[model samples]
Target: MTPAPAGRDPDARASLPLLLDAVLGVGSEPELQATLQHIVDSATELCAARYGALGVVDPERVRLTGLYTAGMTEAERAALPELPDGRTGLPGALISDPRPLMPQDLSKDSRAAGLPPGHPLMRSYLGVPIRVHTEVFGHLHLAGKEGGGPFTDQDLALLRVLASQAGTAIGNARLYETARRRERWIEGAAAVTTTLLAGRPAADALMCVAERARLLADAAAGVVLQPTPEGGMEIVAASTHGDPGDLVGTTIAPGSAVLGQLLGGEPVFIEDSATDPRMTTPVRERFGPSMMLPLQSGGRLIGTLALPRPRGGRPYDAVDRLLASQFASQAALALVLADAQHDREQLAVYEDRDRIARDLHDLVVQRLFATEMMLESTKKRAAAAPAGDTVGEDTVGEDLARAVDELDSTIQEVRTAIFALQQPPSDAPTTFRGRVLRETGGAAVLLGFQPSVQFTGAVDTLLPEPVAGDLLAALRAALAAAHRRSEVTSIEVAVDATPARVRLTVTDDGRTTSGTRGTTRTWESAL
Candidate 1:
């Protein structure tokens, strides 16, 4: 069609070539928001309109998401009750069927009558949809001619060309953004796999997953929940920016839809956990979007990895869900591999311990027993010697008896060491209180019943090693003395370590009525 006469557009038509050049060049703006804003500004300048707004449509085509306005003061825009929902008014027509229109008067249009209370007055209107390829992304709406006349045909034609270029710029910006986001997610998944394979503890492996996933997804919190014996799931590890004492130990019951799916090794995605009927946990109320992925590999279900965003945070897009799911799979494989490595290392340790235990029993115990036998024979010979030599023989016998006692004690200790070495590594004691429990538990085999042991304060951390060793010796002596008594029934041991001192009291019902034979032993040491 022919353009409007020079009499109408006059000076405005002269700048149309430069305007097209500028609009087409906005694709290199690099930033998505800036590129979009520049497009709106270019449209207003090219059309010579007093007010301009670029309404961004939501992905679902439900409503306008954001407004990029030009030629309006910040205060004026802020005073408005709410931004325009472009899909509801005159602009909605463009979204339904994108096309250019320059209405003679908007006040006569019924759809433009329901303006918010603080809206500005306008008459002439021009609008066009900004399409990204085939999708109607949104519309550029302008009103009221700048020079106080109608929008000529030349002005409408100019906007259509600018709209085409704006679409290209917007599309390129989005592609760039998606690429950068995907890069971060890929790197994050790789980091988690590397960490899990580094032979850390099982707990640490889970924690590495939680921390990395939280950062990658930009969620409020990340948690790894392991199945409990009760057919439910309990949070074993949690990663949060602040205090996480409450996140750990949270449980998802057996019957919830989300929990059931996760337990069965299926993934769950919720747009709004706070309102989703399938989410039954109270923690869901604090989150909007969420993803629950099962960590399974080789037909074994490890657990569920959950990432939850804050109550109003943006929902995850298709790309986000896909990347996160793939990350979860890689993480699960890493966890299984890490667990196997740990088991192998532990097996090697146990084998070495068994060899050491055998050497102690076979060599050390035999030698000590042989030496004790020789001492016993020498003592027998001394006791039988004649009266003139009685003095020397008695002295010789006394020395031999003490040596025999020492050898017997050494043999008993070696036997206990062998028993300890033969037990699983988990059974080993890393704390003083644990060692004391080990001692009492061993004594139960001979006592025919278990002893009740009670601890108060931080005995394991606060008690010194030497003082603890002395207490153990006293406890052994008392228990051994009680075992020799007639009809010993029960034993109770208590260790109370305060800031001032550590005290141990061993009381037994087996204490004989003859006080000289058995007694309650109390051992105390100053801190």
Candidate 2:
């Protein structure tokens, strides 16, 4: 196309370059907020107006929820009693119709509601709605024409061009921002899963989820609540900039409206927790917009994850809700997998204990018992030697008796160990016989092997409390004495209980201080 003569269309020649520059200026900013502000600034400059603002429309409420302005000083803004909500005057008219508004004089326009108190005055008005695809994103307002003249049709046309380009720039910025936000949430979920599966304790794992979610959601607090036996939900973990003690342990009662939904595994989103009738917890008044998401995996409800912002904080949008729910689902699955791994680890430990017990019983105990029998036969033969044979022979017989007693003690110690290894690691034995076995089991660690244990005639039933206490005390003293002996090799513990009496016999093949080998100590008490 041939260009029009500059001399004939001087206004067009001057305005076309300014319009192109303004379009490039608005699209240059990649950030959403920066892009919006730049559009407002460019429009005010292009229209030669002293003031300009962009009012963002909330589709749900059909109201201006946010405002970005240019050419207004900080002091001037601070002096104003309140900002406009785009619900009255020309701004409201523009929003209702989504069409351009250009009045020759604002005072003559019926839609004018007059300037707000302490706000700058003088008005040659121009307003235009900005569109992104098919939706009206917001409207741009310009007032106080710089040359003290009313905005002309030429100025309005220039602004329309700028607004159209601004829409495309805003759309691209929004898409970029959404992609970045989704990336952050995904990374947070992956971090939580890695931490949970790293063998963190259950409490720590719950806390990790809360902390990570709070950071990603930009919430004031993050909390995890588990179902109680009473069918209520109690906060078990909390993450917040402030002390979380107040949040932890807060409960939603069984009959509470929110609790019912949470227990049923449904998510609850509250516009303002402080004012929501469904919120009944004492701590609810401290929060504003909140999301309570159910943490569940395969129909098993693990808990609830709650992210609550401070009162009057920004409300979560549709994108925020969608990302958070996805995080919750992933976190729940990780929790279940971690729990299963922990159970498998415990089973492996138990199996190892069983193997050790079997080895002691089937191999060590049998060999020790056979040795004890062989020693007993040797002692008997030596005792039958002639008394007049020699002093050396007498010494040999005494040593043989000690050897036989030591073998018997060694066999008993191995048996005690086998029994101890068979008991559950977490459960403490309550019965008196079990308690006696426990004591001997403890001594085995220091003794390098288990001590022998024998329970005669219903020891757990027949032994009285007082008798059992005293017998245990005497048994401890005897074991200590045996441990003190340098040559101590084995200990035999025998607990005999009857209807009338109980006797605890402790014998060790340890040499006494007086050089005598084989020591026997007995504690007797009446039932």
Candidate 3:
């Protein structure tokens, strides 16, 4: 085999259509694995090679991390020897130099002396380094052009251009992976929020989050550790393919394993869980690698999320950690908000019950007092009447007695009204004024008169629980005060609410004459 002529124009348009179709055609698609396979196929066809592969470089291990091939049976491709590290073979050499390679004959070349044992079907080879900026990312290798012919200079130029485009595609794929991971995290977070708000138990909510985490991260298992009463940790939830009973309900002492780091409000990464010094039990051997992140809210450590990778899998990368941590934080916040909303609802119920109790007491007591007054007045008038004209006295006594009986019946009717008022509202009213009216109607019987009420300006559209309670209490007080005045004829109540403030006024046409009025007491004293 002879070296191809070197003076061919580097910018030749012969392979431009193929290059454009390969790079720009499927670059932004969501399916990353399929897109990568397309790149390998296009590279092989552009170079007219019988076999081709794109090998992803692993910096840490200094070897091929992943490999995709075209024009080979599955068994044949699987049997290919592994490419080693440190510039040993053609692929490694091209990667290290970050340039193109055009080897005419591999068997006759001294530089290819230590090729891996049992390497198959290679007499001529050509490759180009895929690069991002100045750093070499990987390499694209073509083995033996068709018809046993040497590769032309034009072939190397085309491969180089394709390699450049391939690098951009690889970068785009990585970015797409990141974005997809982020989208999954967001969906998981939303699910956690829904479960928590639906009033699922804390343990159940945590389990839901763990299950989603395992699926999103492609991990073997997931666990949630919550701080215990003894300043330790309790494994409240665990999601895994195997039996989770061993992990669930387990307790970890403070400063024990990765759970401790999480309890201390810091995230921990165990690239090799079996070898880490913190592993205190044989359980760590079950997983080869793992990542643990703290679930925190408002600077407080609420719990931890622990995820374990499958056996023979690489450790979690930066993107995985970022996504996991974000999900953990959202889960924590959801738990907190759910608890807070529940507490607020409970408090509102308590307040409403108390107001109902007070209103019933006021109405019942006032009616009973009026009944007692009517009975006493009748009794005194009957005793003082003369005994002459027995028939006339008897008629007078009968009339007085009938009036007392009627008053007693009215008092019983008022007691029934009070009983109805003692109960809370069954459903939420549509508007704030409607709620206010419902509340005021319950207390109206206590005032002994139907008070005229008017609403001016925009009444409150929706009253917050606190403001509603306050307004109900104030309205009752004002109505009671108006009823006590002898000159009071009509009463009017108004509520004016704006975005900035709420104001209420209660006015009555009532006066205290100099001689007929009793000594006055303040409204606060009555309350």
Question: For model 1, where is the 10-residue window of minimal lDDT?
Answer: 418-427
TM-scores vs. true structure, each candidate: 0.65, 0.73, 0.63
| Candidate 2 per-residue C-alpha lDDT over 1-527 given as tens digits, one digit per residue, 9 for 90 to 100 | 88777666668568888899999999898899999999999899888899999998877667777789889999999998877777888878987899998888888788988458998885689999999999999999999998799998889889999999999999999898899999999999999999998888899999999999999999999999999998898999999997998889999988898887899999999989999999999999989999999999999999999999999787888889999999999999999999997887688658757766776778667767676676667667667877677875766667666766666555555544444454445344568888788677767777787899988899888877777767765665577567767688889999887898888899999888799989999888877
Task: In model 1, state the lDDT of residue 6.
Answer: 60
Which residue pairs in model 3 clash with each other?
Answer: none
Candidate ranking (lDDT, best to worst) = 2, 1, 3
Could you give candidate 1's per-residue lDDT for residues 302-390 as a string of tens digits?
99999999986767767788888988888999899988877876886677577667767786677677777777777677768777897
Model 2: per-residue Cα lDDT at residue 245: 89
Error of 2 at 228 (Å): 2.1
At residue 176, candidate 2 shows an lDDT of 88
Deviation from truth (RMSD, Å), model 2: 14.1
Clashes of each: 0, 4, 0
Root-mean-square deviation per candidate: 12.6, 14.1, 11.1
Enumerate residue pairs that collide in model 2: 412-452, 413-450, 413-451, 413-452
